[model samples]
Target: MRTLVSRLAVALLGLTLVAALAEPVPAQKRGGTLTIVRPTDPVSLEPNLETTAPGAWVYFNMLEGLLTLDEKMQIKPVLATSYEVMSPTKVRFKLRPGVKFHDGTPFNAAAVKFTYDRALHGTPPARWASLAGSLAGAEAVDDLTVDILTREPYGPILRTLAMYCMGIVSPAAVQRLGADFSRAPVGTGPFKFVEWKTNTHVIIERHADYWGDKALVDRVIFKVVPEEGARMIALQTGDADMVLFPSPAQLPALRRDPKYTVHETTGIRVVFVGMHAGLPPLDDVRVRQALLHAVDRQAILDNIMEGSAGPARGVLAPGVFGYKDMQLDRVYPFDRARARALLGKAGFTPGPDGIGGGQGAVPRVGHGVPAAPRQPAQPPSVHAGLGDVERGCRLLALRALPFEAGAAGRVEHVAV
Candidate 1:
């Protein structure tokens, strides 16, 4: 991960630094409410229902899955003490003893089986079902042992179990609360969910009887401030101790301030332009290649992104499993001449206004790019760059597709 300075408050600063440096550090002082400001509210507290970062972030504090990934991306046991791959389609897990959920329900093979079964066959299907589609079922062999069965030989089962969506919830609590379980979550983590007040805040208090290491802070308040400027102001005015997704433009100023810390790491997120290949014009590989050639990705990275992100080589980013440098042998350079020639060969001829049309003019390609609340202006700049590509190419027209806030699922369809 690329290095950036500290962004977390004093309570979390130690943990963040330790993870970054992989070195022992000073002991954290306990007993204070650490307020974290975010651009958007979590869609749901139920891990099975929501898959967005906002929801997952909250889940990390309140939920514990069977397995977890370390900073090195290696699978580590959490609720399950150890696991054995018995066969190509079956795996067995030994549950940790004496662990209890926040609601006092015991953590055992039953809990694991319940969690998995609920996710697989719940009335409202789990959003995570897509990730665990290969999973057939989970069975409790005994109080301390559970068996996970896949439809076939699923190699990434361990990694998939480490995902937040696989977090074990108290079966008793789920049965009691039913649909209300999403609002009032109960888990076996370091913290317990206290309250969630719509788009205002979601509060969690440190679990006194936590099975693992106790949290340093007495409470954590995830405050929702839709505006980036407002989140920054909250951090500045002590309303918030930490802020997520601060604008890249504001980083220089934040880095200069001693009162606040600005943390940066090479994230595994890849933001790219996606075209509907099944549609007209875009169906041609040459047209798509032309579009890529017209846009200068380096310029966007250096100028608009303020060097916050590195150039993406492919769909997956660095540090992610199975990421390969696809561009190692071939690179797409920014060349308008090549783009125009490719379009010309594809039967698009420049019109009087420099727009291309042969059989028919290429329709405007609509895209909906997710923008952080702090960097709303940055997306416009990016959109402008994409718009400039259409004008410069005189072959394709690109426009922003309107999308509602927090509607990330809709954006996935437009991925290139």
Candidate 2:
């Protein structure tokens, strides 16, 4: 009996020890407010009418389309459960069931058709019409099936549909709100529009009854802080949870600080110097080719851009579909010797008097080419305040004209 009692006591002690040793399970973080800083406020909450990236940034959380682009630019399913390309000109989509707009309107094939019809034929038409590229029409096969037709074999139709402008809106809400829809947008998204004080800030709240995954954050605030310095200060002072478009100058310091994380990605836009081929000297193919060869793109990237910008090889970036790999060195060989040889071949002989054309010929100084049709002239205020042109003229006067090759058919330290 004593042995039995001792065994029960030991078992009771083990149970107590087990209870004491076990770690407590943590509760999931479900509710918090996130504040984002932007240089500008969104022009409109309605994705279809919005054009600016700042507008899209805000609308993306409140609106969604049948498809979305992944990091690799590949199309991924969103509202649509599955899709099949029937032919080059036709595609079919199977919509996800039980999805409803914020206004409680059903999200169906009818909604898709209505959205596309408005985009294609509505007054003030969609800005992304070019992306849609010859969209014939969209038809509802049934409540959940949609058939989309293109005029020809349009390759970018799927991508176009994935655009923010193509986001499906409630037909009932559009009818009820009419022109006021931009102020109060209602969509089947993770977030619902709350208020947008134009030029100041846009606020959104989490959709509690969201169809798919629930949003972890309770609210999101997009505050406009135009100045980059102001944005950095906001981040430092904990006034902002996140900031967009921090200046490249501040990146080194931001990266060094352990309190924050810095992310870098190649941008979609390309910035290149444009010269008028219709103008004198530039009209010559050899002169144009020589100018390209003379530019040290690597040096410019390193020194001016602080290695933040990448040298553009082709007209389009590499990730873009149908991009062709070109040997950049062969095309624009960054060789001053080659540039001098090419310039001489084009009959551009620099004179002792520091002119590029010939002994008596001088460079034309005014606007090099005719302005485009309907181009407006500078305002009197702008013309009076302009100092850049004078500075440019001074720089041009100081620059040495492209000189001719000597013994080795190579010129050194030639400036333009």
List runs of model 2 lying over 4 Å from the truth. 1-28, 267-304, 327-330, 333-416
| lDDT to native, each model | 0.69, 0.62
Model 1 TM-score relative to the real fold: 0.83
User: Whole-model lDDT for model 1 versus the true structure?
Assistant: 0.69
State the lDDT at 205 in candidate 1: 97
Per-residue C-alpha lDDT of model 1 across residues 310-407, encoded as one tens digit per residue: 66666665567787776711466777777777777887767777664675564345444433332333344434544544453221222222332113
What TM-score would candidate 2 get against the native?
0.69
The lowest-lDDT stretch of 10 consecutive residues in candidate 2 is 1-10
Superposed Cα RMSD, model 2? 17.3
